[model samples]
Target: MDVPFDLNSYVRVLKLASTPSWEEFSRVALIAGAGVALVGLLGFVIFLLMSFVPGAGL
Candidate 1:
């Protein structure tokens, strides 16, 4: 058995999709992604530093 979905429905379902207000959502998502990347880089650096320190016992 198979189910059907009207994927095209979302393309026309929202008047908000074209409004200037929508750009803020995009900006917020970009910033959140960048913040996550920064945190991951910092954590990796810390891990490397700890691994190199004598008897850090990480």
Candidate 2:
């Protein structure tokens, strides 16, 4: 049996994948952090609302 994944292809991918610059990395991190914070806030709001519901057992 022969394998389809060639070592040259892996080398090509490694060559193409470059490290993100500081500016690019920071911008992406800020966006991702904002997204996570927003989702967490939304979840917290939902939890508060659910806690107020009667007989829901929290």
Best by TM-score: 2
Instruction: Write down the RMSD of all candidates, one decimal each.
Output: 4.7, 2.1
Q: Against the true structure, whose lDDT is highest?
A: 2
Q: What are the lDDT figures for the candidates, one per model? A: 0.79, 0.89
What range of 10 consecutive residues in model 1 has the weakest lDDT sum? 1-10
Model 2: residue 39 alpha-carbon error in angstroms:
0.9
Clashes of 2: 0
Each prediction's total of clashing residue pairs, residues at least 3 apart in sequence or on different chains, is 0, 0
